[model samples]
Target: MRALALYGAATTLGSLVLTALTAAPAGGAAAPAASAFPSFQGAPEAHGTELAAGRALAAGVKFGKCPASEELPAPIQCGTVKVPLDYAAPHGRQIELTVSRLKASGKDPKTKKPVARQGALLYNPGGPGASSMYFPLVSGMPEWKKIASAYDLVGYSPRGVARSAPLSCMDPKDFTAAPTQSPIHPSDSYKKERIARAKTYAQGCARKAGAALRHYHSLNNVRDLDVLRAALGERKLNFMGASYGTYFGAVYATLFPSHVRRMVFDSAVNPDPGQIWYRNNLDQSAAFESRWEDFRTWVAKHHKTYGLGDTAEAVQHSYAKVRAELSHKPAGGKVGPGQLQGAYLQAGYYDDVWAMRATALSQYLKGNPKPLIEQAAPRPEAAKDEENGNAVYTAVECNDAPWPTDFETWDRDNSRLAERAPFETWDNAWMNLPCAYWSAPRQQPVDVRAARGALPPTLILAAERDAATPYKGAQELQKRLPGAALVTEKDAGTHGIGGGANACVNRHMEAYLLTGKTPVRRAACAPHQEPNPVSLDRHALPKRIPAAV
Candidate 1:
């Protein structure tokens, strides 16, 4: 959310690859213009060609035929409308962001309205890059469907994300660097080269993306949402966004509060232009260190169960030894720096996977790191064919907010932070290094200040010490957004706030979405109950909650 935190699980997930681990960022997706300007009544005559093309393409977002199509599966009935490359200048180069809806699979039509079509309940997952394309099926978030039973569940892919014209930079494996200590203090030539490499990646994106990249920022995404509202014929927009999506929703709330209906920003992002993504990533390094200690302390207490080490410091040595060994000769044929970095990255997201990570590392230290080794994202053999789910990861991050292009600036800060925060300082530095060479023309991030004009006040969910989007960030946004109630998990290590089996939080969310009943006053949303393996497997079946919009 702060930078790019993906909420979805991957396709070929390991059996031990717990859902609790934070998902790596994914960035990519694009869009095009709509029929004329305001096609609220129906698809415009001027855009007849696009309408036809959309229908043929099975975009699944049929706006002209709204109420009736409300009964159709999003992919089947909705028209995949296109919008401008730049909203301020509608005729600019454009891209397509897929929009779909599971129409209220109910008997009633909004034509029963003075209320005007229960509007639409839109959803977005985090990863300044993640697409809500799959939100219709995110197990714990049936709130989309629940509210959709009356309204429609509109899911959209952010710019250059899934099913859209995604931002293609380097392959995913390239981002997955070797897990060596990306220490800050590199020699003069090494520092210069890394900075140069960052510049090159940025320049490559500028070349490849061209003018189109300039318009792909979040402000554009918010404008696109307005276009979506117009296309849907909905006077107001109802949205539920998580993680980075929350930031998206918050920006929209500030931009178009009058048009927003029943908005819920769970696991928020606030684009503070003053807040550098790189420096914030440094903060994440500290948070991850705490979680690392949590794991070490737990492992030490249960020495027999884990047998990894007796003390946190000892485990640290073991970890360093394994890292050193892997550096000289990877455990399996391929597990190297990237694999270790990735596995460790997983630990930074949530505490639920701490034991599993420990187990993997412990086993690896004990000579059986096959499971952990496999965790490393495989290197791509072909450059062009190597596009990964993480392409969007770069797209959103590098473009969402502006970063200083001067390589020397990064080098100085990165060097200073590396001494104590070695685990992720360098890894994070390289992960974001591409931004220095981002293809898009830099745009200033929106201030994302709260609106003085209030909408239907909603609940804000945040973890106290969320690594990716620090809990304080949530409070910052809360301070900005007037008329919003704050719910904090006292000591949040939970990135998504109310995740896993967090009943107290989920109940409030469910109640809020189901009956528009939020916590009457302030309340301490409880911590996520420890995951019950049995309960989770059973929940593997898609969960649905009707959205009685």
Candidate 2:
């Protein structure tokens, strides 16, 4: 799942496309080797091939100027690390993964010279397909100033992601060539159409990406991360991951516990092997429904400002009315029921945008649909990136674990959930429909449990009301990782907690990263205050809203 901004970087909904452990040691003490741990199911043996690849990356990376990006304005260095396309055959074809770094620099308080460096801190911003090459630049943002000054901030585009042998399914124009189709349709005909489209998309991926799709699962991603660690010349990895990234960190820790220095998992995915992905998506749908109620109530409480409703039910009616009207006649010939739902889905992920979204709804109700239209309109320029993200999302999720091949199972499960949780159930189902027809051979889900006395102290951050990765998942991760600590933002519904507006959450994260000090086993922080109502000026809204996987 795509995470909200890791350190409050401004991310549009378009950018985010849309884990666990056990603990043994504390600090950086060496743990048992990979052979001492239980084997990961369907994982290639950690022998000659893997070791050779690691040695190759240890030759070191040559830094150079990074590609220009308005999204990443910091003076960052970029390079690539070559790894096997398929780890099982490391001597075969190689793929280059794009990497970026923001070298740490800060003066010592006592001495006039630079402070001693604290090693590299690698970041993965979720997306089993999101390009994290810009994350190093994101680390340079003020929210991460302390961490950035201590460690070299690092980011990379994982296999099959942008600048890393990106996977492509169809032409960029095809993404916006047709009017958006709402996934909430109740008709059997609509289901058939969606299934057909899913098949077509899957076929396109097979045609374009070919056999390389088979090598893009979590196991390889974990392997790639290790190679990256070697390329950085770090004996141990200091890391932070959010959303699906939490799972990535968990798998890496499981396979290479001795290599972990300090790690942080924000908005963790459920670590149960049974919930690899499909069941987790269903759970996400229900959680989103709950968060949506939170949004509705917020709008109701501020009814005077929005004028759309005075009660939660009234707000729901207003939303339903707007969705119906958009279905019949799309606003500005672009934003349809599908686009409208996509726009509002952001509210389920973040409360910061609630006021602006509510104001847009009010304007639409007043016959001025421009605000709503602007919110949902597609950016043709971003279509290619979106396509790459979607392709990787399906490729990794589908390849990472087993998914039911039958459409009937998906239809029944989602149809039943949609009755009670209407906001994101259908939309999420359709987003993952491509998985049902995925052509890549699937692997068994990684058993994320770590060996006894193997892992180091890990910190997990979550919001009690997170919709993308629910609060329960964090609790589950805490259970799975023996010595880990969980710091929750009580009653908060935001997807990503660390490096956010919550000072308490940031304190816990900074403490853990800077000093390897974890909070009490189960700690809680007060939620950030809910946003106050605002005027209808779209520009007045906060530019950043956490995007979900």
Candidate 3:
């Protein structure tokens, strides 16, 4: 996906490609001791030997059973970690999160004169809903290689997302979470009913989730990490969180500050704790709409390439006509207004992607079914198919704080805002409506104001253009945290400062993780200074899949 800007807020990908990598974590007691910096204790990077060894290890394992080592992604090595639904009361009930990992490659168990072996580095590709376990051992994010050289890469299904205690509402239909029926245009009464419906949705989740719902909060996931840390016997944690994961990373640091070793939070999340998640989503909605206009304008200017329109207004009208049409009778066979809208929502996440999908829509405007048909089909499954991260996201997000019981507030707030942020008003509402009736009692989001304690010195990353996690949020976090340094990217059109190809960001992050060096003085990273993107040779655009097929 072309990043909308150098910095972006993490949102759900339309359908990110998932490919296989190192086998799932295999058993064999974790190597007992941590290694010194620059010490290569693992096998060197031998694509052939390590690939062979990894396959051999994978071939022998039974599925659904995770070994103690959180460092391989073989089908046999991963199973589940049963954890209490709620962290406040850990002894009561339990839910399971499927976890996976890539063992340090290049390690020769025999000579022990390791080729490369760094500490464990856990990663998350943000989505309050995206799964981390599915991130290719080598994702588009470049830092994976720096950390991957010696350390184990850990990934897991968070709670209430795709796999871990998956939050299934209305079968697959609800996955779109848009209006089931075409929504009536907003009116005072329409707004009122919308509020009522939202309340009902929240209540329904509460009823369905029962006691287990309480366990799904950011703190609990942190607790889960504590458990995993103990289970893996890692003395401290190293983490790389993008988008929603950034917020998750922050929560973890706040709750268990001492346990942190090194972390990179990219495309940052606003962790103010007071702002509602839906409200945050609203900000993203507004940003996306603005970007969409830019896209329309760009397309209009390049009518020959796109054939959408020769003027911005014409292109906007073209897109609006589709919106209006979908608002009434959806196009194609099965996609409804909500699905179309949700797909539009999916379309706007990255700048690079919007144009391609927009072009696809442009082709659709000509009455070709290919674009619309592609939009209606299910996305390709991840090569190493693991559960997506919906459960983990909801588990932690729902528990992090409480929502207003008054549905009127929700309706009043969203309806009024939707008028201005038409692109994502109700869509964002439904994306979060489940919280209204969340089954568990809402735990107050942690009031985390970081104080420089003995926790490891950390690096904070922010992209000035990031809308999902706004640069201000990252700035605020950097200001509050102790022993932390901040890095910013200016005039860039992608999210996540340290990820992707920017060498400026990569070099600093590399030095930090590889040598325990935090950016002592804050610096700026721009696209020109960025490293070449991963797979620059394979310039496939971001893939946008149907909301639900």
- Best TM-score among the predictions, by candidate number: 2
Would you list the clashing residue pairs of candidate 2? 1-549, 2-549, 18-549, 19-269, 21-481, 22-481, 23-482
Candidate 2: where is the Cα deviation over 4 Å? 1-45, 69-71, 108-114, 183-185, 535-548
The CA lDDT at 337 in model 3 is: 56
TM-score of each: 0.77, 0.90, 0.75
Q: Please, what are the lDDT tens digits per residue for candidate 2 over residues 1-549?
A: 432211000242112111001112222433233343234464454542344334433356787887775245557888888887877766578889888888886653335467657888888878677876766755545567777778888888888888898898888778655346575646899888889988998899889988787888888888888778766766688988888989989988887787788999999999788998899999999999999999999999998888878999999999999988877888898888777777788888877778889989999999899888787777677788777888888788888888889999998999999999988888788778888998889988878877666888999999999999988888888888778999999988887777888888888998898888997687889988778787445555332213336
Regarding TM-score, does 1 or 2 come out ahead?
Answer: 2
Tens digit per residue, CA lDDT, model 1, 1-549 = 223321110243222122211222111111222322233234232233223223222332444332352343324334466776654444445567676665554432234332223556777766666666544443225433344455566776767764567776554555544444333346777666677766766666666666676666666677677656655545456777777677767877776666666777676654465664655666666566676665567667766766767998888787777767777887665666546766666556655556666767777777787757655535444223224234556666677777767777877776777777666666667767777766565656667765566667777877666666666667777777776767777655656643234666776775666566766545686565543212312113212221100
What is the model-wide C-alpha lDDT for candidate 3? 0.55
Point out the higher-scoring one by lDDT: 2 or 3. Answer: 2
List model 3 lDDT by residue over 279-392, tens digit each: 566566566665456556656767777777888778877767666665566555445555555455544444444555565667667877466546543333321121123333
Error of 2 at 289 (Å): 0.4
Instruction: List per-prediction Cα lDDT, in the order shown.
Output: 0.57, 0.77, 0.55
Query: How many clashing residue pairs, candidate 2?
Result: 7
Q: Predict model 1's lDDT versus the native.
A: 0.57
